[model samples]
Target: MSTITYYLDMQRPEQIIGKPLPADLSVVECQHKQYQLNRFLYQLVGEPWQWTDKLSWSDAQWRALIEQPGHRTWVAYYQGAVAGYYELLRDAEGVVEILYFGLAEAFFGQGFGGPLLTQALQSAWAWPGTTRVWVHTCSLDHPSALANYQARGLRIYREEVEAEAP
Candidate 1:
Protein backbone atom coordinates (compact mmCIF):
# COMPACT_ATOMS: atom_id res chain seq x y z
CA MET A 1 0.00 0.00 0.00
CA SER A 2 1.09 3.55 -0.60
CA THR A 3 0.37 6.44 1.74
CA ILE A 4 0.44 10.19 1.45
CA THR A 5 1.62 11.41 4.80
CA TYR A 6 1.22 14.89 6.19
CA TYR A 7 3.78 16.30 8.56
CA LEU A 8 2.70 19.06 10.92
CA ASP A 9 4.39 21.36 13.36
CA MET A 10 3.59 24.07 15.88
CA GLN A 11 6.32 26.61 16.49
CA ARG A 12 4.73 28.54 19.30
CA PRO A 13 3.50 27.15 22.56
CA GLU A 14 0.94 29.90 22.82
CA GLN A 15 -0.77 28.73 19.64
CA ILE A 16 -2.89 26.12 21.43
CA ILE A 17 -4.47 25.31 24.71
CA GLY A 18 -5.52 21.97 26.07
CA LYS A 19 -9.17 21.11 25.84
CA PRO A 20 -10.89 19.85 28.93
CA LEU A 21 -11.35 16.10 29.21
CA PRO A 22 -14.52 14.41 30.39
CA ALA A 23 -14.60 14.02 34.14
CA ASP A 24 -14.07 10.30 33.97
CA LEU A 25 -11.18 10.41 31.55
CA SER A 26 -7.62 10.89 32.77
CA VAL A 27 -4.11 10.85 31.32
CA VAL A 28 -1.14 9.26 33.06
CA GLU A 29 2.48 8.83 32.11
CA CYS A 30 3.61 5.27 31.45
CA GLN A 31 6.53 4.80 33.84
CA HIS A 32 9.22 2.60 32.36
CA LYS A 33 6.82 -0.27 31.81
CA GLN A 34 7.80 -1.76 28.47
CA TYR A 35 5.43 -4.73 28.54
CA GLN A 36 2.36 -2.67 29.31
CA LEU A 37 3.34 -0.02 26.80
CA ASN A 38 3.84 -2.66 24.09
CA ARG A 39 0.46 -4.18 24.86
CA PHE A 40 -1.23 -0.83 24.52
CA LEU A 41 0.56 -0.06 21.27
CA TYR A 42 -0.60 -3.36 19.76
CA GLN A 43 -4.17 -3.06 20.95
CA LEU A 44 -4.61 0.62 20.15
CA VAL A 45 -3.05 0.37 16.73
CA GLY A 46 -4.36 -3.05 15.82
CA GLU A 47 -5.23 -2.19 12.25
CA PRO A 48 -2.66 -3.91 10.02
CA TRP A 49 -0.74 -0.98 8.58
CA GLN A 50 -1.05 1.36 11.54
CA TRP A 51 1.41 -0.30 13.91
CA THR A 52 4.09 -1.78 11.73
CA ASP A 53 6.93 0.27 13.21
CA LYS A 54 6.88 -1.16 16.69
CA LEU A 55 5.34 -4.47 15.74
CA SER A 56 8.41 -5.32 13.71
CA TRP A 57 10.87 -4.58 16.49
CA SER A 58 12.47 -7.31 18.58
CA ASP A 59 11.70 -7.20 22.31
CA ALA A 60 15.09 -5.81 23.30
CA GLN A 61 15.14 -3.20 20.59
CA TRP A 62 11.64 -2.06 21.49
CA ARG A 63 12.58 -1.73 25.13
CA ALA A 64 15.71 0.21 24.31
CA LEU A 65 13.76 2.66 22.18
CA ILE A 66 11.23 3.35 24.89
CA GLU A 67 13.89 3.67 27.53
CA GLN A 68 15.79 6.35 25.71
CA PRO A 69 15.93 9.67 27.50
CA GLY A 70 13.35 12.25 26.42
CA HIS A 71 11.07 9.52 24.98
CA ARG A 72 7.84 9.28 26.93
CA THR A 73 4.46 7.62 26.65
CA TRP A 74 1.19 8.73 28.15
CA VAL A 75 -1.81 6.45 28.51
CA ALA A 76 -5.35 7.65 28.82
CA TYR A 77 -7.91 5.95 30.98
CA TYR A 78 -11.68 6.14 30.83
CA GLN A 79 -13.25 5.21 34.14
CA GLY A 80 -10.05 3.30 34.83
CA ALA A 81 -9.79 1.09 31.75
CA VAL A 82 -7.14 1.76 29.12
CA ALA A 83 -8.69 3.90 26.41
CA GLY A 84 -5.77 5.20 24.34
CA TYR A 85 -2.20 6.48 24.32
CA TYR A 86 0.28 8.91 22.75
CA GLU A 87 4.06 8.71 22.68
CA LEU A 88 6.43 11.67 22.47
CA LEU A 89 10.08 11.85 21.52
CA ARG A 90 12.22 14.91 22.15
CA ASP A 91 15.57 15.28 20.50
CA ALA A 92 18.61 17.08 21.94
CA GLU A 93 17.91 20.00 19.68
CA GLY A 94 14.64 20.82 21.50
CA VAL A 95 12.18 19.54 18.93
CA VAL A 96 9.35 17.41 20.23
CA GLU A 97 7.53 14.89 18.10
CA ILE A 98 4.24 13.23 18.74
CA LEU A 99 5.65 9.85 17.82
CA TYR A 100 2.30 8.06 17.99
CA PHE A 101 -1.25 8.77 19.05
CA GLY A 102 -4.41 6.71 18.85
CA LEU A 103 -7.37 5.31 20.71
CA ALA A 104 -8.21 1.66 21.10
CA GLU A 105 -11.14 0.24 19.11
CA ALA A 106 -13.31 0.18 22.22
CA PHE A 107 -12.89 3.90 22.73
CA PHE A 108 -13.48 5.01 19.19
CA GLY A 109 -16.53 7.25 18.50
CA GLN A 110 -17.06 7.88 22.17
CA GLY A 111 -15.93 11.52 21.72
CA PHE A 112 -12.72 11.10 23.71
CA GLY A 113 -10.26 11.62 20.90
CA GLY A 114 -10.23 15.39 20.81
CA PRO A 115 -9.70 15.83 24.50
CA LEU A 116 -7.03 13.16 24.62
CA LEU A 117 -5.20 14.82 21.77
CA THR A 118 -5.49 18.18 23.42
CA GLN A 119 -3.84 16.76 26.50
CA ALA A 120 -1.08 15.26 24.43
CA LEU A 121 -0.31 18.50 22.66
CA GLN A 122 -0.40 20.49 25.86
CA SER A 123 2.00 18.06 27.49
CA ALA A 124 4.37 18.29 24.58
CA TRP A 125 4.51 22.03 24.78
CA ALA A 126 5.18 21.91 28.49
CA TRP A 127 8.53 20.20 28.08
CA PRO A 128 11.32 22.64 28.87
CA GLY A 129 13.24 24.16 25.95
CA THR A 130 10.73 22.88 23.42
CA THR A 131 10.97 25.08 20.36
CA ARG A 132 8.64 23.05 18.18
CA VAL A 133 6.14 20.21 18.34
CA TRP A 134 5.39 18.00 15.38
CA VAL A 135 3.46 14.92 14.23
CA HIS A 136 2.89 12.91 11.09
CA THR A 137 -0.25 11.15 9.95
CA CYS A 138 -0.71 9.01 6.89
CA SER A 139 -3.67 7.65 4.91
CA LEU A 140 -3.49 4.41 6.88
CA ASP A 141 -4.28 6.11 10.18
CA HIS A 142 -7.74 6.66 11.57
CA PRO A 143 -9.91 8.76 9.30
CA SER A 144 -10.01 11.61 11.78
CA ALA A 145 -6.31 11.67 12.55
CA LEU A 146 -5.27 14.62 10.44
CA ALA A 147 -8.34 16.64 11.26
CA ASN A 148 -7.85 16.04 14.94
CA TYR A 149 -4.32 17.41 14.76
CA GLN A 150 -5.47 20.44 12.86
CA ALA A 151 -8.26 21.06 15.29
CA ARG A 152 -5.69 20.94 18.07
CA GLY A 153 -3.72 23.66 16.23
CA LEU A 154 -1.03 21.78 14.29
CA ARG A 155 -0.58 23.08 10.80
CA ILE A 156 0.55 21.03 7.83
CA TYR A 157 4.04 22.04 6.82
CA ARG A 158 4.81 19.27 4.33
CA GLU A 159 3.39 16.15 2.71
CA GLU A 160 4.52 13.37 0.40
CA VAL A 161 3.50 9.98 -0.89
CA GLU A 162 5.44 6.84 -0.03
CA ALA A 163 5.04 3.15 -0.73
CA GLU A 164 4.48 0.69 2.06
CA ALA A 165 5.08 -3.07 1.86
CA PRO A 166 1.91 -5.01 2.19
Candidate 2:
Protein backbone atom coordinates (compact mmCIF):
# COMPACT_ATOMS: atom_id res chain seq x y z
CA MET A 1 0.00 0.00 0.00
CA SER A 2 1.22 3.52 -0.68
CA THR A 3 1.99 5.86 2.19
CA ILE A 4 -1.10 7.71 3.45
CA THR A 5 -0.63 10.80 5.58
CA TYR A 6 -3.59 12.55 7.33
CA TYR A 7 -3.29 15.81 9.22
CA LEU A 8 -5.14 16.93 12.41
CA ASP A 9 -4.50 19.70 14.92
CA MET A 10 -4.23 19.07 18.67
CA GLN A 11 -6.00 22.21 19.81
CA ARG A 12 -8.90 22.02 17.42
CA PRO A 13 -10.86 18.87 16.61
CA GLU A 14 -12.96 21.07 14.35
CA GLN A 15 -9.99 21.53 12.03
CA ILE A 16 -10.62 18.08 10.66
CA ILE A 17 -14.38 18.55 10.90
CA GLY A 18 -14.95 16.23 8.01
CA LYS A 19 -18.52 15.97 6.71
CA PRO A 20 -20.40 12.77 7.55
CA LEU A 21 -20.04 10.16 4.85
CA PRO A 22 -23.23 9.19 3.04
CA ALA A 23 -22.34 5.55 2.67
CA ASP A 24 -22.27 2.92 5.43
CA LEU A 25 -19.47 4.97 6.90
CA SER A 26 -20.54 8.03 8.84
CA VAL A 27 -19.90 9.68 12.21
CA VAL A 28 -22.36 11.37 14.56
CA GLU A 29 -22.60 12.83 18.04
CA CYS A 30 -23.56 10.43 20.82
CA GLN A 31 -27.07 10.92 22.18
CA HIS A 32 -25.65 11.07 25.69
CA LYS A 33 -22.29 11.12 27.41
CA GLN A 34 -22.85 7.62 28.69
CA TYR A 35 -23.71 6.39 25.22
CA GLN A 36 -20.71 8.26 23.90
CA LEU A 37 -18.56 6.34 26.37
CA ASN A 38 -20.21 3.13 25.22
CA ARG A 39 -19.01 3.64 21.66
CA PHE A 40 -15.45 3.06 22.83
CA LEU A 41 -16.60 0.11 24.88
CA TYR A 42 -17.74 -2.27 22.13
CA GLN A 43 -15.47 -5.06 23.34
CA LEU A 44 -16.16 -4.33 26.93
CA VAL A 45 -19.55 -5.24 28.54
CA GLY A 46 -20.56 -7.49 25.66
CA GLU A 47 -21.88 -4.81 23.34
CA PRO A 48 -22.33 -5.73 19.67
CA TRP A 49 -19.36 -4.97 17.49
CA GLN A 50 -19.74 -1.83 15.40
CA TRP A 51 -17.99 -3.45 12.47
CA THR A 52 -19.75 -6.80 12.64
CA ASP A 53 -23.32 -5.74 13.49
CA LYS A 54 -23.86 -2.89 11.05
CA LEU A 55 -23.51 -0.44 13.97
CA SER A 56 -27.09 0.67 14.44
CA TRP A 57 -27.83 3.29 17.12
CA SER A 58 -30.86 5.11 18.54
CA ASP A 59 -31.30 8.84 18.07
CA ALA A 60 -32.74 9.26 21.57
CA GLN A 61 -29.62 7.71 23.06
CA TRP A 62 -27.39 10.11 21.15
CA ARG A 63 -29.17 13.23 22.32
CA ALA A 64 -28.24 12.75 25.96
CA LEU A 65 -24.50 12.57 25.35
CA ILE A 66 -24.68 15.90 23.61
CA GLU A 67 -25.90 17.63 26.75
CA GLN A 68 -22.94 16.87 28.97
CA PRO A 69 -19.98 19.07 29.73
CA GLY A 70 -16.44 18.09 28.88
CA HIS A 71 -17.86 15.90 26.15
CA ARG A 72 -16.94 16.59 22.54
CA THR A 73 -18.17 14.59 19.56
CA TRP A 74 -17.43 14.77 15.84
CA VAL A 75 -18.24 12.40 12.97
CA ALA A 76 -15.98 11.50 10.08
CA TYR A 77 -17.45 11.88 6.65
CA TYR A 78 -16.29 9.43 4.04
CA GLN A 79 -17.18 10.36 0.48
CA GLY A 80 -19.37 13.13 1.90
CA ALA A 81 -20.99 11.28 4.81
CA VAL A 82 -20.21 10.37 8.41
CA ALA A 83 -17.90 7.38 8.41
CA GLY A 84 -16.36 7.37 11.91
CA TYR A 85 -16.23 9.28 15.16
CA TYR A 86 -13.82 10.46 17.89
CA GLU A 87 -14.69 11.70 21.35
CA LEU A 88 -12.66 13.60 23.98
CA LEU A 89 -13.60 14.34 27.56
CA ARG A 90 -11.88 15.73 30.67
CA ASP A 91 -12.43 14.70 34.25
CA ALA A 92 -12.38 16.87 37.35
CA GLU A 93 -8.72 15.95 37.76
CA GLY A 94 -7.97 17.73 34.51
CA VAL A 95 -6.71 14.70 32.63
CA VAL A 96 -7.73 14.67 29.00
CA GLU A 97 -9.81 11.55 28.48
CA ILE A 98 -10.21 9.49 25.33
CA LEU A 99 -13.76 8.61 26.27
CA TYR A 100 -14.72 6.75 23.13
CA PHE A 101 -13.30 6.46 19.63
CA GLY A 102 -14.41 4.53 16.56
CA LEU A 103 -13.72 4.65 12.84
CA ALA A 104 -15.01 2.89 9.78
CA GLU A 105 -12.40 0.36 8.66
CA ALA A 106 -12.29 2.05 5.29
CA PHE A 107 -10.82 5.15 6.95
CA PHE A 108 -8.04 3.27 8.68
CA GLY A 109 -4.53 3.22 7.12
CA GLN A 110 -5.61 6.52 5.56
CA GLY A 111 -4.42 8.51 8.61
CA PHE A 112 -7.36 9.23 10.97
CA GLY A 113 -7.12 7.59 14.41
CA GLY A 114 -3.41 8.20 14.83
CA PRO A 115 -3.56 11.95 14.46
CA LEU A 116 -6.73 12.22 16.50
CA LEU A 117 -5.11 10.23 19.29
CA THR A 118 -1.87 12.16 19.00
CA GLN A 119 -3.80 15.40 19.25
CA ALA A 120 -5.66 14.11 22.31
CA LEU A 121 -2.38 13.28 23.95
CA GLN A 122 -1.00 16.63 22.95
CA SER A 123 -4.02 18.24 24.59
CA ALA A 124 -3.39 16.30 27.77
CA TRP A 125 0.32 17.10 27.82
CA ALA A 126 -0.59 20.75 27.52
CA TRP A 127 -3.04 20.71 30.42
CA PRO A 128 -2.09 21.97 33.89
CA GLY A 129 -1.83 19.54 36.86
CA THR A 130 -1.84 16.62 34.48
CA THR A 131 0.94 14.38 35.71
CA ARG A 132 0.27 11.33 33.54
CA VAL A 133 -1.76 10.29 30.49
CA TRP A 134 -3.19 6.86 29.86
CA VAL A 135 -5.91 4.72 28.19
CA HIS A 136 -7.55 1.39 29.07
CA THR A 137 -7.44 -1.56 26.67
CA CYS A 138 -7.49 -5.36 26.79
CA SER A 139 -4.85 -7.79 25.54
CA LEU A 140 -7.08 -10.74 24.76
CA ASP A 141 -10.45 -9.49 23.54
CA HIS A 142 -8.99 -6.88 21.23
CA PRO A 143 -5.37 -7.46 20.34
CA SER A 144 -5.10 -4.70 17.73
CA ALA A 145 -6.36 -2.20 20.29
CA LEU A 146 -3.47 -2.91 22.63
CA ALA A 147 -1.00 -2.42 19.85
CA ASN A 148 -2.64 0.83 18.88
CA TYR A 149 -2.43 2.10 22.45
CA GLN A 150 1.28 1.31 22.61
CA ALA A 151 1.82 2.94 19.26
CA ARG A 152 0.24 6.09 20.71
CA GLY A 153 2.84 6.09 23.55
CA LEU A 154 0.38 5.10 26.28
CA ARG A 155 2.03 2.87 28.88
CA ILE A 156 0.42 -0.26 30.24
CA TYR A 157 -0.23 0.54 33.87
CA ARG A 158 -2.55 -2.40 34.44
CA GLU A 159 -2.67 -5.77 32.80
CA GLU A 160 -5.05 -8.73 32.88
CA VAL A 161 -3.34 -10.48 30.02
CA GLU A 162 -4.98 -13.79 30.88
CA ALA A 163 -8.40 -12.90 32.19
CA GLU A 164 -10.73 -15.71 31.29
CA ALA A 165 -14.27 -14.66 30.42
CA PRO A 166 -16.68 -15.16 33.27
Candidate 3:
Protein backbone atom coordinates (compact mmCIF):
# COMPACT_ATOMS: atom_id res chain seq x y z
CA MET A 1 0.00 0.00 0.00
CA SER A 2 1.09 3.57 -0.62
CA THR A 3 1.71 5.96 2.24
CA ILE A 4 0.76 9.63 1.76
CA THR A 5 2.39 12.57 3.54
CA TYR A 6 0.34 15.69 4.35
CA TYR A 7 1.15 19.39 4.01
CA LEU A 8 -1.01 22.49 4.47
CA ASP A 9 -2.41 24.21 1.39
CA MET A 10 -3.25 27.90 1.76
CA GLN A 11 -5.08 28.76 -1.44
CA ARG A 12 -8.84 28.86 -0.84
CA PRO A 13 -10.36 26.83 1.94
CA GLU A 14 -7.16 26.42 3.95
CA GLN A 15 -6.37 22.97 5.38
CA ILE A 16 -3.83 20.81 7.14
CA ILE A 17 -2.31 18.16 4.89
CA GLY A 18 -0.57 14.84 5.51
CA LYS A 19 -0.89 14.68 9.34
CA PRO A 20 1.13 11.46 9.22
CA LEU A 21 1.01 8.52 11.59
CA PRO A 22 3.87 6.63 13.17
CA ALA A 23 4.49 2.91 13.70
CA ASP A 24 2.51 2.72 16.90
CA LEU A 25 -0.28 4.99 15.62
CA SER A 26 1.22 8.25 16.79
CA VAL A 27 0.41 11.21 14.55
CA VAL A 28 2.98 13.43 12.88
CA GLU A 29 2.79 16.21 10.29
CA CYS A 30 4.24 15.78 6.78
CA GLN A 31 5.45 18.38 4.34
CA HIS A 32 6.14 17.57 0.69
CA LYS A 33 6.03 19.36 -2.65
CA GLN A 34 4.38 16.65 -4.79
CA TYR A 35 0.74 16.43 -5.72
CA GLN A 36 -1.42 13.68 -4.24
CA LEU A 37 -4.09 12.30 -6.57
CA ASN A 38 -6.53 10.69 -4.14
CA ARG A 39 -9.30 13.19 -4.91
CA PHE A 40 -8.94 12.77 -8.66
CA LEU A 41 -9.02 9.03 -8.21
CA TYR A 42 -12.26 9.28 -6.27
CA GLN A 43 -13.69 11.42 -9.01
CA LEU A 44 -12.58 9.15 -11.90
CA VAL A 45 -12.04 5.59 -10.73
CA GLY A 46 -14.36 2.55 -10.86
CA GLU A 47 -17.93 2.67 -9.55
CA PRO A 48 -18.71 5.01 -6.68
CA TRP A 49 -18.26 2.50 -3.86
CA GLN A 50 -15.39 0.69 -5.51
CA TRP A 51 -13.87 3.89 -6.86
CA THR A 52 -10.15 4.70 -6.25
CA ASP A 53 -6.86 5.43 -7.95
CA LYS A 54 -6.15 1.85 -8.92
CA LEU A 55 -3.49 3.08 -11.30
CA SER A 56 0.07 4.24 -10.93
CA TRP A 57 -0.34 7.95 -10.27
CA SER A 58 2.00 10.50 -11.81
CA ASP A 59 4.07 13.05 -9.92
CA ALA A 60 2.72 16.23 -11.51
CA GLN A 61 -0.92 15.68 -10.55
CA TRP A 62 0.02 14.85 -6.98
CA ARG A 63 2.09 18.01 -6.70
CA ALA A 64 -0.78 20.19 -7.85
CA LEU A 65 -3.11 19.06 -5.08
CA ILE A 66 -0.31 19.69 -2.61
CA GLU A 67 -0.27 23.28 -3.78
CA GLN A 68 -4.05 23.73 -3.83
CA PRO A 69 -5.69 25.35 -0.82
CA GLY A 70 -8.80 24.32 1.11
CA HIS A 71 -7.65 20.68 0.91
CA ARG A 72 -6.24 18.37 3.55
CA THR A 73 -5.00 14.75 3.64
CA TRP A 74 -3.84 12.23 6.19
CA VAL A 75 -2.63 8.63 6.40
CA ALA A 76 -3.27 6.20 9.22
CA TYR A 77 -0.63 3.85 10.51
CA TYR A 78 -1.47 0.64 12.29
CA GLN A 79 1.29 -1.47 13.74
CA GLY A 80 3.83 0.20 11.48
CA ALA A 81 1.73 -0.29 8.33
CA VAL A 82 0.08 2.41 6.24
CA ALA A 83 -3.58 1.56 6.72
CA GLY A 84 -5.79 4.30 5.24
CA TYR A 85 -6.24 8.04 4.58
CA TYR A 86 -8.81 10.90 4.71
CA GLU A 87 -9.04 14.70 4.39
CA LEU A 88 -11.22 17.58 5.61
CA LEU A 89 -11.97 21.22 4.85
CA ARG A 90 -13.88 24.05 6.47
CA ASP A 91 -16.80 26.03 5.15
CA ALA A 92 -16.93 29.81 5.23
CA GLU A 93 -18.59 29.62 8.64
CA GLY A 94 -15.73 27.53 10.03
CA VAL A 95 -17.59 24.22 10.04
CA VAL A 96 -15.39 21.36 8.99
CA GLU A 97 -16.50 19.18 6.10
CA ILE A 98 -15.04 16.07 4.55
CA LEU A 99 -13.40 16.80 1.24
CA TYR A 100 -11.78 13.51 0.24
CA PHE A 101 -11.37 10.14 1.87
CA GLY A 102 -10.45 6.48 1.32
CA LEU A 103 -8.65 3.54 2.87
CA ALA A 104 -6.03 1.31 1.30
CA GLU A 105 -8.07 -0.97 -0.97
CA ALA A 106 -6.73 -3.99 0.88
CA PHE A 107 -8.03 -2.57 4.15
CA PHE A 108 -11.61 -2.35 2.97
CA GLY A 109 -14.40 -4.21 4.86
CA GLN A 110 -11.91 -5.15 7.58
CA GLY A 111 -13.47 -2.60 9.96
CA PHE A 112 -11.03 0.30 9.41
CA GLY A 113 -12.74 3.01 7.37
CA GLY A 114 -15.52 3.58 9.87
CA PRO A 115 -13.31 4.07 12.89
CA LEU A 116 -10.87 6.15 10.94
CA LEU A 117 -13.72 8.34 9.74
CA THR A 118 -15.07 8.57 13.24
CA GLN A 119 -11.71 9.72 14.51
CA ALA A 120 -11.27 12.25 11.72
CA LEU A 121 -14.75 13.68 12.16
CA GLN A 122 -14.15 14.06 15.86
CA SER A 123 -10.96 15.91 15.23
CA ALA A 124 -12.69 18.23 12.80
CA TRP A 125 -15.66 18.86 15.02
CA ALA A 126 -13.41 19.49 17.98
CA TRP A 127 -11.69 22.35 16.26
CA PRO A 128 -12.48 25.57 18.17
CA GLY A 129 -15.36 27.72 16.87
CA THR A 130 -16.57 24.97 14.55
CA THR A 131 -20.21 24.18 14.02
CA ARG A 132 -22.32 21.73 11.99
CA VAL A 133 -20.68 19.68 9.26
CA TRP A 134 -22.14 18.50 5.97
CA VAL A 135 -20.79 16.09 3.33
CA HIS A 136 -22.63 15.09 0.16
CA THR A 137 -22.23 11.80 -1.65
CA CYS A 138 -24.36 10.30 -4.45
CA SER A 139 -28.02 11.17 -3.95
CA LEU A 140 -29.31 8.89 -6.71
CA ASP A 141 -30.51 6.23 -4.25
CA HIS A 142 -27.14 4.65 -3.46
CA PRO A 143 -27.26 4.50 0.33
CA SER A 144 -24.20 2.94 1.94
CA ALA A 145 -22.16 6.10 2.52
CA LEU A 146 -25.24 8.08 3.39
CA ALA A 147 -26.36 5.43 5.78
CA ASN A 148 -23.01 5.48 7.48
CA TYR A 149 -23.30 9.21 8.00
CA GLN A 150 -26.81 8.95 9.42
CA ALA A 151 -25.64 6.24 11.78
CA ARG A 152 -22.94 8.59 12.89
CA GLY A 153 -25.55 11.32 13.69
CA LEU A 154 -25.20 13.43 10.56
CA ARG A 155 -28.76 14.12 9.57
CA ILE A 156 -29.36 14.13 5.84
CA TYR A 157 -30.79 17.65 5.78
CA ARG A 158 -31.50 17.68 2.09
CA GLU A 159 -31.10 15.50 -1.00
CA GLU A 160 -29.87 16.90 -4.26
CA VAL A 161 -27.84 16.16 -7.35
CA GLU A 162 -24.07 16.23 -7.34
CA ALA A 163 -22.73 19.75 -6.88
CA GLU A 164 -21.54 21.08 -10.21
CA ALA A 165 -17.81 20.62 -10.59
CA PRO A 166 -15.64 23.69 -10.83
TM-score winner among the candidates?
Answer: 1
Worst 10 residues of 3 by lDDT: 4-13
Give the clashing pairs for model 3.
6-17, 6-18, 7-17, 13-70, 34-62, 34-63, 35-62, 35-63, 36-62
| Candidate 2, 1-166: lDDT as tens digits | 2222122112322222232223444444554456544444433322323233314656565545545675565555657844455566666765556655555555555555555555455555555655445555443223355555556656555443343455
The lDDT per prediction is: 0.83, 0.48, 0.51
What TM-score against the true fold does each predicted structure earn? 0.89, 0.52, 0.57
Rank by TM-score (best first):
1, 3, 2
C-alpha RMSD in Å of predicted model 2 compared with the true structure = 9.7
lDDT of 1 by residue, 15-107 (tens): 775578999998999776675476557656565445755666677887777888988889898887888888889999989999878888888
Local lDDT at 149 for model 3: 54
**What is the model-wide C-alpha lDDT for candidate 2?**
0.48
